[model samples]
Target: FGKENPLKANEWVRTFGATAGDPEGARLNLWAPAEARSAGGKSEIGYWGMELGRMLVESEQMPVCLINGAVGGTRIDQHQRNVADPEDVRTIYGRLLWRVRAAGLTHGIRAILWHQGENDQGADGPTGGFGYETYEKYFVSLAGDWKRDYPNVQRYYAFQIWPKSCAMGVNGSDNRLRDVQRRLPRLFSNLTVIATLGVKPPGGCHFPAAGYAQFAGYLHPLMRQQLYGHARTASEFPGLQRAYFVSQRRDEVVLEFDQPMQWSDSLMNQFFLAGQSGLVQSGAVEGNRVILKLREPAAGTSITYLDSARWNPENLLIGVNGLAALTFCDVPIDEQ
Candidate 1:
């Protein structure tokens, strides 16, 4: 409970089948940013509360409390009170969820989304500061606390403290923080830390409103696709060889298989064009599919697959058949 707009809870009615009220039998509490929580004042939750709300509505998932307890200058240490069980909580700072099972809030609270540490980035000690060893213990300690109370609860999605302006890895804060953050998934079977590694904007520790919106943009559409996209078998999302955003009209964005691509891991939202002017996002789906609609000629334009981070200079998707399905140029098929 740090300060300002603690939470902004709401109930997003499922669009299709479910009439009004909580869809799929879940009573998502939609915890609004703590400051706005006139009902409950717990604002130090972190922007994740806001982010989670956006994802729920965007992903069009079940009901959610979507609480926001972020304080302007708060750190992870502040979440101790939120821990579902006070007796179970054990961090020096004390930031965590109260054992809802013990407090008697809801029967099945799926999981908790913890995100913090912008403030503690510089605090010195064990795990790079909290004693590298202790840093590791904090995670187990926090999870153990929760597991003990909510016995059935397991899935956890915590943030690996964002890139710090504190020291950028010199004192090993960034590195150690990351090391500690990455260990969660390994330490706990149901735990996962959504990688914000390359997702952060330039000089931004937390995404601004615009940045936040874009992040939310994907959840809804992707969730909708998931309805039709979820595979019935183990081989649902097969590996595809290419990904990118098309930038030109008629730019044939062909996804060549690393090995024939019978199917893909997911209908890749791939398409990106990078050339003399760096890179830009591709446009909508076309006839059979949509390649980024090019407003300009592709004569000199260079198209890249996926994000700038996704690169294959050799175009491995090309295969022994050579750059067969590859579309390196925006050239029109000429019939002389």
Candidate 2:
């Protein structure tokens, strides 16, 4: 999401059909710090792809080809294919499909880095009534198409958008969309969601060069863990597994994570007791769980963390893999 001009070229990286003239999808030389340039270096350089590809090539000691068919400000529904001709070149989905087929990568794709939902979330662009349920439906359809099209695709890395700076007039919609994105892994076996809350330069809807580079940094290890079966710590997302009260003190709730995690003390106010007057007064990291001390009793109240669409925290609760916790909304608390 950064870079006005192309950077140095990486010989190990290549692109297929970045221009209209290249119908055969020739493997053209790409220019960037570590990524294949989109539109033959005529478009903005996405550092995430560039750096991630560089890491992959360095780790595997082989060349990697990137086929990017992303259209900016497109809704998830726009990516849906026409059933009559799924690969119709006139449509967005078809164009991507056409490129994949033309490049002979219909069965060779290792992973898909899905970073979208700005427009669909009613933030940066028109939503057209694309709400939570509609998004889930369209995403499911798209995933189905991918499953059928890219039969060999191993990983589906979904990026959960940071709604704070992105929200325009629809804060609820933004948060809901993010929640849906965070829950995508539960819907698909190969899908994993990456949190974007911790990325730096979080001023505008699009991040700066360093932010996109951080995105790549977060993705590389996870990709290695999934694609190469490498056991890398901090590669796994520190997602919330459950929330419950550990003892008779109804003022405190324990958030259990899926993996061991670490946190900064500055995020006490980030946790919210839904419908409750006071915020989380304090928090402690213990092994894989976090104990949040609330100003009021949290009984019968739902819990949320970093869920506000306009709240951007400088500090984050990161996992062993250096990834932040996926933002959650209205996560019900259980009495344990």
Candidate 3:
């Protein structure tokens, strides 16, 4: 996911300033235009944040506000805090902080929907050697700064960038960054990773309106469960539990998921093996596990999914709830 530039009329409107219909006296007051009406009589439909807010307002009958801070074509370093002056508007992080404070929302933030990293995934330039360790360090510092500033913020919904959307050519470093992103939840207690593997209209660095709407559809329900305690019976978000060889020979590997899985298509060619194996000849679902049959004897010491960052829109391994599996790279294959 990326910034929705030139925001559509009703998709998202100014929450602060006189334009939002706040008291003209307080020009800086920020308010959620939950029922905001344009000059026309019809109510406005939305894409990502708006759609999610609409669902929350309709289902829970509560007001939801989205404070968007995403800036297109920005690297992780650009978002680093200006420790010398946290409110220095010249810096990206400082500017966002200044805006939030100006709107009297320093403490009102409940969650953050973060969709970035496209700019940082480039094969060269700023992202040339920006592997997992560098990104993790920068992001950790960013998160710490946020927690210090916005103490009440509870959740961080980070969107894992797809290889197809990388601004530069795909490489192992890009997928390595993705692997780090998908593992963010483990690094922070309040963070959760949202996979972008199977999202539609996926060729661009930024998704179109329809693709974002689809993303909102997948996100709203999980938000309901996480923030509202709506669905507590089972895991609403699914992830890879473990991957291991089915036998010592390693001819077959099994990818176990936290939930039952289903494939959208026959081809699971996205998987690759390292070590002695040639390739993943074929794969199939067996209950909660994906059995990958190697063309040769199973001798690989490691396995990787979404190998080479191939973009397959229709073919995906998804959970029963329809959430796609997060791309994992060089996951160690456990011996039986």
Candidate 4:
């Protein structure tokens, strides 16, 4: 395989296979099992993969293959392996490489879709919760190693860790992990962290079947914009750009977005200002911008939107495209 033989890696290009009822042409495998089920029936339906592949094939008018090597309840550490040890097939990372070789996909790996970190946030396990800094270290290392092994893979997409049902303190820690995920793009240019704010989890930590399908709905448009470059309008995927104080009084802080604002009254309620007084009040949206009215001078204040440690059924800072605005905190008001 590619691990033992460097020349074999070049053979991982597009290949064709013929199966029952399917023609002898290039086809994308929806998931590893082809059933789109995982984690003891607590995982997504792989609608995202199927829809993404469909978009690519239809838009480009070419055949493309999509494969999944994801396993539920696995921590980032479980996937982080020693790339130098080619014979070490102990981790999921090793198994992933083996699967790639088995599938004869050594030539190209366009992108990797990652949705993990829930298991890492748990309190009990060998790979239990860690600080954001530590989590970032592990994740960056993992991505770097994967890219090193699969040189054809240039882009990595990951879903932000969604809200979970945990103790208040644990929830806070999980939010920090989510923040780490959000900042991953800053660390790695090829990485894009998809927001999972509006998608509600069905029960413990898994998205419902409907949630998975809806998540695919959100991802498809993003892929169109980010990957295919079809939707060139900002209205397709609204995201926060910068936040700063617009007034010398420091009472009002303005939030700027990548797209035009479609402000709603309910979205205004989601904004919060944390100052020395703990939780300050917020104000209404004004013309594609959110104004935060602090109770006091915002010298040491931080503005956060949809920043909840626990599940909030009413968190509604959605973009015009129906995707939720990413949770963010901008402080040092004068520095903007």
Highest-lDDT candidate: 2
Ranking by TM-score: 2, 3, 4, 1
Q: Which stretches of candidate 3 lie over 4 Å from their true place?
A: 1-14, 17-46, 123-128, 233-237, 263-265, 275-278
Identify the candidate with maximal TM-score: 2
Residue by residue across 28-88, what tens digits does model 2's lDDT show?
Answer: 3323233434454332235667777788899978888766667776678778879999866
What lDDT does candidate 1 reach at residue 299? 51
Q: Residue-wise lDDT of candidate 3 within 156-218, one digit each (tens)?
A: 888888774655434566777788887787789778788776678764566666687777877
* TM values, all candidates: 0.46, 0.86, 0.82, 0.75
- For candidate 1, the C-alpha RMSD (Å) to the true structure equals 14.2
Q: Evaluate model 1: give its lDDT.
A: 0.38
lDDT of 4 by residue, 3-66 (tens): 1211111111122221212121113232232224333222122555554555556666766665
For candidate 3, the lDDT comes to 0.68
Q: Candidate 2 at 119: error in angstroms?
A: 1.1
**Runs in model 4 lying further than 4 Å from the true structure:** 1-33, 38-47, 58-61, 84-87, 122-129, 165-171, 200-204, 229-237, 275-282, 286-288, 309-311, 329-336
Ten residues in sequence with the least summed lDDT for candidate 1: 13-22
How do the candidates rank by lDDT, highest first?
Answer: 2, 3, 4, 1
**lDDT (CA) per prediction:** 0.38, 0.72, 0.68, 0.57
- After superposition on all C-alphas, the RMSD of every candidate to the true structure, in Å, is 14.2, 3.8, 5.3, 8.6
